[model samples]
Target: MGDIERALQTFHSMRVSAIMPPIFSMPIVAEDSPIVDVLKLLKTRHHVWVVNNKDEMRLEGLIRYMDVMNVLLPPEHTKARLGNISSLFKSILGGAEKASDVMERNVLVIEEDATVLDALKKMKRYKVQILAIVDENGRLVGEVSLRMLIDEFLRLMKLGGAQWTQHGSSSRSESH
Candidate 1:
């Protein structure tokens, strides 16, 4: 490919390997683990992966901090009528539930070798904020979010001297 094509190609197909940290390093829990465990983990972590195998961490799905809140908090009307009392009850009761009961299944995932564009496309299609990264074995290896992707993109654009921003635009208009 030409120099321009190669440079542009980086924008379209930057591999996740360049950005993702090792996945196995993240927190994981058994699917049947009590929700209380997840809540405790989330105190210091954004989310935890749920695994099916107790002996081995085989990812089944993921439980986000927001998902736990969704379970503990009542709907808008319910909240208005029941006030904080009902939600307080749920906070105590919800802890008894298992991870599988709350974790989001069929989570969108991208292979480690896939491009950032591929990951972005899947996230958009699934309407999800985060995506699990998997290996050829389809085992959870890492996680990526739209925030990370965009930040990395912006960093690259700035480094490339593309001058696509307000300053660049003003300069272009002045030159014309």
Candidate 2:
């Protein structure tokens, strides 16, 4: 079988827990945090941080690279724009915002026990590059990237078309 075939097979046979990359780290900020602060965090982080009210690590949403880029783009340059400086000031102040204001809340998520195929399907369906791995309790555990999946798929192909095996099963854990 080929890499895609093997990956598909693995997705059918194993759970996401088996092949997910070990959690490196995740940056987080409160839901009502100032956009400036979130921007600062994004500047020195891997992925967008997530947070809820009370400054808790709820992983309620994500701010991807594109999200930041969208924010950085001048409003006049895009169809989505604030009508006046007052609106822009409100956006910068974070007072006129909600967690849903700047977050990709409708994110694709998969369980740790879900098959790799599940992740792949979700990615394809959503046309996204990343999937948030959540546990049974609905807590964010880690993220799975398309790059990680491709690497694993390549490794499987190198196994001389052998049955897919998990490279590692360690859970990528994170804390607030």
Candidate 3:
């Protein structure tokens, strides 16, 4: 098979676990954690996963940097509903205290057993760069990122003896 074909095949056949980052590397905060803590984590990462306080393994929600920004500084075009205004003031006045108060409750996730191709498709469909990986019991495990997928694809191509060039074509193939 050609290099591209081989890469595609590998992506389709390989499970998400093959590319998922270690669970400990993921920033996780309890739902009851102060929003300040989430913000602290967001300083170095795009988002933080929120888990149930009573059961840390269970996935609860996620807080993205944009989520905090939106709550604290709503878009100018946004209509000032009473609730929306209240949330903004609360956030500014320290009333919006916990991660759950500002988290996006419906976080997109992928099963750990899913294929890399499945993860790519889900990420594309959801227009997201990362996905929280869950096990069969729906416990938070780790994460798979678009960058990881790209790196894995490049590694697969190299293993297939294909050297990609700036022109987007294989310059040469190494002999087995």
Candidate 4:
């Protein structure tokens, strides 16, 4: 009936397809891609990169920031010490020599038709900040970030607040 109510309804019905923004970076590769290259792609562009093993780009898995960080920071006394930039570089170069070595095969993805609330819940449950928005064909279309959600929510709040102020002023004038 009012702006706030309309906003709430819109939020409840918003599908990932409608709210998801364009994909930031698509660093995709086959199974045999070098891990070092993948790491470079992730570092320079995306926090997560998708991988496909078959002919079709089926949702295989995601490589995350933590995975790359782990390779960069190896266990103590293995060969090199921590805090050494050279050692860190060597470790990353050594371990992630191959993409399969460092890639996180377990990836979480969301469908286009899923509600924004569903995406929020999934992100909260996984403690992740971003989710890949995919279609039924398993093709990545866009992404949804927490910042985007917060911005949209704040915009709705402002709209609702303005509507309430106008309604209050009108009611006061009528009473007078």
CA shift of 63, model 2, Å:
0.4
lDDT values for all models: 0.69, 0.63, 0.80, 0.65
Cα lDDT tens digits, model 2, 61-98, are: 87765566545555444344556343232232333444
Best by lDDT: 3
Task: Provide TM-scores for the models.
Answer: 0.69, 0.65, 0.83, 0.65
Backbone clashes for every candidate come to 1, 2, 0, 2
Rate residue 166 of model 1 by lDDT: 50
Evaluation by TM-score, superior candidate among 2 and 3: 3
Q: Could you tell me the TM-score of candidate 1? A: 0.69
lDDT of 4 by residue, 1-176 (tens): 65566666777678877777655445666556777667777767556555465355565566666555657766442344466433333345454465555566666788888988898899999998888777888776667778878777657656565244645431111323
After the best TM-score superposition of candidate 3, give how far the Cα of residue 94 lies from its true spot, in angstroms.
Answer: 7.0
Better of 3 and 4 by lDDT: 3
Which ten-residue region of model 1 has the weakest summed lDDT? 167-176
Task: Give the residue spans of candidate 4 off by over 4 A.
Answer: 24-31, 44-46, 53-55, 75-95, 157-176
Candidate 3 has which clashing residue pairs, if any? none
Ranking by lDDT: 3, 1, 4, 2
Candidate 2 backbone clash number: 2
